[model samples]
Target: MWSSKYSEDIKEKVLEMYLHGEANVEKISKRYGIPASTIKNWISLYWEEEQARAERSKAASRRKRRFVNGKELRVVRPTSGSAYIDWRRK
Candidate 1:
């Protein structure tokens, strides 16, 4: 029987590859000796998180576009020489 602790880590790695569009659930399950259904569940959770992240990024961009509700912001360079903060809003 697989332990919950190890299964959790395996689930993370499986979901990572799935989210990156590299592997499907069946392949991941075969590689990890886990069930396809479990892999599918993990993939679903990963996609949900990915969607949430995309939503957050969209919201952040929208917020950066307009001076709203006195939100405190910290500027960080997303790339080298891209020193302008909130450049995504542009």
Candidate 2:
């Protein structure tokens, strides 16, 4: 694709502008002399990449929460006992 011919830096800026409603594909294409389809492709690619990143981040946070909440680490000491072995719940 013609868009692939451009450098990563250029494509990233184009994607940012498109995402923020600062510019549409046609406007950016005309301004940069790139193809409109290329701009559209860049925008699509950017959104897909961002969605995947968000999903991964959400999964990581869920795992951390489960690990922290599911484990019981508190320790309780046993009280004094007589001749017979006995256990009591506090």
- Specify the highest-TM-score model's number: 2
Q: Rate the local accuracy (lDDT) of all candidates.
A: 0.69, 0.71
Task: Find the 10 residues in a row with the least total lDDT in model 1.
Answer: 64-73
Pairs clashing within candidate 2: none
Q: What are the runs in model 2 whose C-alpha is more than 4 Å off?
A: 1-3, 64-90
How does residue 41 of candidate 2 score in lDDT? 75
TM-score of each: 0.52, 0.63
Cα lDDT of model 2 by residue, 1-89, tens digit: 12467898888788878878998888999989999977777777777888999999999667522223455333333645524423333
Name the TM-score of candidate 2.
0.63
Candidate 1, 1-90: lDDT as tens digits: 233545666666876788788887788888888888877766666678779999999998886434335544447778877775442321
Q: Highest lDDT among the candidates is held by which one?
A: 2
